[model samples]
Target: MAGSGDAAKEYIAGSAAGVAQVVVGHPFDTVKVKLQAHNTKAHRKLYKNASHCTSRILVEEGIRGLYKGASSSFVGIALESSLFFGTYAHAKQLLQGKYEDGKPQLQVIIPSAACSGALISCILTPTELIKCRMQVQGKDAMHATWYSSPLDCAVKTLQSEGVRGIFRGGLATLFREAIGNAFFFCSYEYSRYWMHSYTDSPRFAGNSNLILAKDVGIGIISGGISGMAFWTTTLPLDVAKTIIQTDPSPLSSRNPLRVLSMVYRRAGLAGCYAGLGPTLARAFPANAAAIVAWEYSAKVLGIRGS
Candidate 1:
């Protein structure tokens, strides 16, 4: 089991990594959410694709517009990541028992990841609801009441829908996080194992002197692969969650299946992946940076291993 010190280090590292991820990835995330929640019939279809979304935001709303809801995202990510990494570390330590050296086997890692993902979903649901709502506000003429900031959005949601409003899409978030993170953590651990054990990749070869560089490199590779795996597993559920979070009607937002069915009726299977392009585009680089930061920070703080 990890000592108290190790747990503290893991939390700090995860929070730091979350900050880095939010700073680099929030813009792409904004675009992705906007596209997913956008309604072609309701709006004029301002953006043709991910690239078009980027250009439109740049031209019309300037740099600030692309970073909508960044403040809430930053805090939410920090808390969620801290809890996730810390929980994963604790779970792994417990599952691995007396520690037989090397890695802790896939069986232990996978369950640990699932536990962490489920736990993080509690925080992620509310955070994402606010962020998505803020992101799509200006996209439609009907939602023209501009939220001055994340705080404003939170206050409005609370006043309008009570505490339940904050957790609008909690079930969908739980499903996505549990299933997606299982694949994500497995892919990352397996990728790192392959790089070090099979490929004899210099980036992950056993060398204490190069541990920092190796951890960061391994993290980048693992994170990229995990991002792809995560999105692939959970995109459809994610679409359901986004629709629920962004729907103006309280009744509509409560039923994820109904929203998903609406998406299918409106655009079929393709509609279920409305923002796939932007999401995949962001997934690799964003997750790469996030994991790199996470691993490197952990190492610097004296928490070691994959």
Candidate 2:
């Protein structure tokens, strides 16, 4: 009974932390995506660096520009992370309770996170679509005069492509979130453990580190490495997803390799990674801070996220 209760608490706490992540880091996410996927031509080669990109966006679009699609992103992150971490926390509890031969198995970890991520994909797709359209609104508005606002985009999608249009890039989004988040949390947990064990830092995984002058540096390093890995793995899919979301048409092919070949032919290798640098820079800090905040929040709520 105690164990089950612990699990339930953890699940609830995870959702709380997820909410924390979105509130703190979403604007950076907005700028990152817009700089990459905006359908603009004047700012085609917009920011020469991550800082430049953000500054340019603010200068051109104002503070609200920095927060474009914020509400949608908030909704998407809140829903997705709630489902994601809630399921993941509960699944971990269930797996721990069901131990193989009375011992927890390490192999099931990946599967648990995978299942959590898949469910989150469904919850996230529509709102994320709204967020995407809003973020990319400023990208050379000439070619993307299709929708007046995020709502219009949603309406147009429903009108033209039906349910699938609203979720035009859902499959890729699913793969991105499921695989990306599975690895994200999994990597985060493992890295935190190794850091706690190896480093001499006080407060290896939380904002509480400020109190300890911490050396839990591994979390940052591990997060960066993992972020890079996850992004690289799904980058091709991301490219495809972006194309489907932003381009005038849905991708006819699902094969990752074929999409790459086509993208290369049409947009070139540079196009494949059109907005990669900002993405990584943005992703690394946003994700790392999110993970740290999430894990710490769970602990504060008396739930063991790991």
Q: Which 10 successive residues of model 2 have the least lDDT summed?
A: 35-44
User: How displaced is residue 127 in candidate 1, in Å?
Assistant: 1.0
Write candidate 2's Cα lDDT for 192-246 as tens digits: 6666566645454566545233432554566566666677666666766765666
Q: Where is model 1 more than 4 Å wrong at Cα?
A: 39-46, 98-104, 139-141, 199-212
| Cα-lDDT of candidate 2 | 0.65
lDDT leader: 1
Per-residue lDDT tens digits of candidate 1, residues 178-217?
Answer: 8898898888878888776764556645676576566667
Please provide TM-scores, in order, for all candidate models, with all chains considered together: 0.91, 0.78
